[model samples]
Target: MNILHHAVLVKSVNITSVAKLLLDNLLRHVREHVASIGSLSTMTVATLLDPRFKTLGFLSRNKVQEAVRRLKSECTALIASSEASLPHPSDAGESTNNSSELWCLLDETVDQKRQSFNATADAILEVEQYLVEVNLRRHQDPLEYWHKQKHVYPYLYHMSQRFLCSPASSVPCKSVFSKAGRSSANEETAYNHKQ
Candidate 1:
């Protein structure tokens, strides 16, 4: 397929939705890791508390106990919050099965992601503004300007790439080659050769 056609296909796929799907996958991975950590912590605690060897080092025992407590609390909290925030399994499954619907959903997701990106960009800009004002007031050298710019550079680049790939900017892949067929050079050459 041509570049334009490829772009059109990508645009049709609904990137925002794809990003959300990826985010969901990431969350699931994180949840599973948390659960595994919790289980490991519990096993560690059980092993430490076993009375088979009364000669265990005090520091090692204390460390294991502290780690178990912290891991249990943190993992429980993380799992609870993540589970609560996730979409219902049936809903997620349905979404996965419907490709066209997923495209619509993805558009919505992209919109939300864009809003989030904008907010982050604005906050970064505000910080830079604050720094500039402070430096100007204090008559300090603005040598740190580059440092401030660096913080927003990645976001700007991301936004640019996103905009370029968005449906509105995407053109059909066939258009790239189609233009050649419409060139006036061939017509001009034919007329001169006939003359």
Candidate 2:
């Protein structure tokens, strides 16, 4: 949609005044409706995650930054959630010494915090690298690209599956239903004639 909006939205076009006015009105209405539906975070994230169309559909770098920030936030949340859901190991047999055990707990606390901080940093770097890489070929499938990259970016692969797997709008589904209904009706008419 964003691509289409920018495609013909240039003053360099040589159309007549009346034609240009009609185009301006059409662009205005399309922009208004797209803006209304553009608040969806999923759409933003999906566009960013798509290897073929990453950030190209966005109007500005700030918008790209916003999407990247949102992706990182969700990535962090997913990391934290997975850690919380994991089974905890049973406590070891009673410690032989109290002094070491007291300090070990403190060490574990520090280690865990450091690990969490590092995890977030690593995730941010991953997002940056993904964005920096050139877009995949238009003929390539985003999901397939992600699948091949799963080992390199497991978190993003999981996320891309969640976001990119579904159709963005209902239009495709509606068209499919309409076509199916017409085909079924035609088949019924043919069957009636045969009988």
lDDT of 1 at 14: 50
List the pairs of residues colliding in candidate 2: none
What local lDDT does model 2 show for residue 24? Answer: 85
Candidate 1: regions farther than 4 A off: 1-100, 135-195
Off by over 4 Å in 2: 10-12, 85-105, 167-195
Model 1, position 47, has a per-residue lDDT of 25
After TM-score superposition, the amount by which residue 155's alpha carbon in candidate 2 deviates from its true location, in angstroms, is 0.8
Q: How displaced is residue 105 in candidate 2, in Å?
A: 5.7
Instruction: Give the per-residue lDDT of model 2 (tens digit) for 64-180.
Output: 788889889888777767776766554566565988688678777876796688668877987888888999877788878998999888888889989985444333334444665
Instruction: Write model 1 residue lDDT over 1-195, tens digit each, in one string.
Output: 122234444555556888768645544543443334323443333222222211121124444456435333433443344444655333343444578687768776775566555554454453334323322322332233333444544332322233223221112212322444454468788899999
Which whole-number lDDT from 0 to 100 does residue 76 have in model 1?
Answer: 40
